[model samples]
Target: MEITIWDEYYELLPRKELEKIQLNRLKRTLIRAYHNLPYYRHKLEAEGIDIHRFKTMQDLKHLPFTCKEDLRRAYPFGAIAEPLRNIVRIHSSSGSTGSATVVGYTAGDIEIWAELMARTLTGSGASEEDIVQVAFGYGLFTGGLGAHYGAERIGATVVPMSTGNTARQVQILQDFNISVLCCTPSYALYLAEVAQEQKVDWSKTRFRIGIFGAEPWSEEMRADLEQKLPIQAFDIYGLSEIIGPGVGFECQARAGLHVSEDHFIPEIINPDTGEVLPPGETGELVITTITKEGTPVIRYRTGDVSSLIPEPCACGRTLTRIKRIKARTDDMLIIRGVNVYPSQIESALLSFKELEPHYQIVITKENFMDRVDIKVEVAPEFFSDEVKTLEKLKQSIEEKLRAELNIHCHLRLMEPKSIERTSGKSNRVVDLRKKEGLT
Candidate 1:
């Protein structure tokens, strides 16, 4: 397999030299965090740590862990290290849980973000000649602008579709002869379905590469997407707290996502104990921004569960790669004494050829006990009027869910297009337990 290299200087930087650069950046970031941010300053003082004497990467473990709550407590601008005038752009989290956490970027920070994005696009098999259409929503969300800047930086013709208007998105994909598509994984699959319904011929256009992220999807989902869209689908990972969609990207090998070690440091730690686990041990992902100047974070707990692959990738990039996220620590659901993740349910549902990847997990309290019910939509052809056939299908799905989720769950089969679809991130889980007066 042929792989595209974006920046030979940094992407292929020597390990020793890279570490030296990281240490320098880490020291500078800590200095700024200690002197500029009150929250970080207080935390460091309470720990009896001298920010000026902060030494090497090994010292990362000694620093305090920053969580989403820290950012929330700091609110919009307290986390920022640079002056307000230096900030050129800001992107914020959706704050579905609470107050939105804001992330700022200086002029230089934006350039670095664009560079990382360019690397992401090229690493996913895109080129300067390819026409890239970004379907992620723009504005306070980072997905749209992050992808837009990166594609432009790579000299690709960017459509800047910026989510919604599914009909128009299809029209642009066909009319513009777009070779690369960027959006959430669920949106990609949804587009494939809509395009087929509109009789858009794939062979006529140059649509072959898909860059998907902003949600956790299974390998089964990837295979289903590849078969449905006839494209090489690659997973890109990032968050607003980090640098949006360019923090890590998969190469042609598709084994793991290579992190941009020159700018960010990745660590896996036990969610409960906070002990940094060795490579290949699954735990919550923690990150520290080494080069970020606007709003640098130290040991920011991402809450994503995955392991590090210390082994060199076949693509020849020496940067360490992280296994695709299995499930976020916070996304894990406890039901009937068993821990379950939505991706586990998704993997089981997508395994069946007769079912679509569209499903919803509904959690509600029943008689003081937690219950999980999955409502899945079957392929249009698989939906039948026969009661026996439908029941058999439901039984098969329930059995598979039991094997994968390790707990029996109530399963219901629905007709095609019965579940709500979105061009943005798909809301797969509907937890009604809270509304039922259970905390």
Candidate 2:
């Protein structure tokens, strides 16, 4: 239960002092964005935002809000604040949802990112002595390099095992004696399954801590991981648009992910009205990059739903903590007038001992009504159960789903390993309404 904090001076700064730093950085970011980036300038002018008159943090409400669409519109380089000559590195989104959001970083920005990630690793109980293995993908995706730099910054022995090759990942876990692992939560579960298949002894492995993010997971998922693997799983939160994976991290307290307030300012706003909600109120997450020089966003709407915890953490960091992100506004599924989130389904499925964590939510429109069909993989032991037993289990699962989601769903029990697995973010939801010309 050792509490390790990187850059204690900044991480444990008093609330009043942190606000002063945030205000100063906010002003600098606004001035640079308004002057260098035409996109911000136009938005600021249209909203009649006066950067100089911003006396308190409350004035941030007057600034224009940025969204993914805006970043997509900016594309390649429209959002970058610094000159091309000064930009040192670039990372981008997968463009799987839309046009990719490209984020640039200056040498200073990279240093800041490394520092924030160092704090993240330290907060997650990773120390310089730990041999860290980063399983997130490299290149355009930010997770791999963001973690690589952070582990290096903290003086840890880093093994850059960038995604895929499940067998090799397990081999390295034992061969390299990796003490810390970083990857998506689903992928971690997949690795554990693979390890079991290989008959690898978890007790012999040095793996102790796992830092997972880049997709939404639930507490039930965390419990499953801890039960399956020999590690204490911690959640980390960040997006490529907001300095990759260093925006926030979980401390030893495991209460909530602490926002790196000195570097980025976070707010919760009503997704529909764009009105900022008070702390402890659930809403869309909005972030403003105060220290980012290459692409400083002004109240950028993250599309993530979470609330802020203003109370100080037992870890002793003054940074505000955000409830683990379980759903995004855009990811919420409206099925037959009921709102359903994939995580909700995952939670329900994991609650059943007969069900594996791997599942998919297939949404389609049937006769002008939305239908949710969940394909869940049964645990290996239950896969061979009698048809009657399987049917009874399926019925029980459907009843649980009905109770939890308040919506009827067709649950299909599949043999173990039937559902496809990925080394990166697992695709949990398949929405075919638009493809079926029903949207």
Give per-residue CA lDDT, model 2, range 78-109, as digits (tens). 99998999999999999988889999999999
Which pairs in model 1 have colliding backbones? Answer: none
Q: How many residue pairs clash in model 2?
A: 0
Runs of candidate 2 exceeding 4 Å displacement? none
TM-score of each: 0.98, 0.99
Question: How many pairs of residues in model 1 come into backbone collision?
Answer: 0
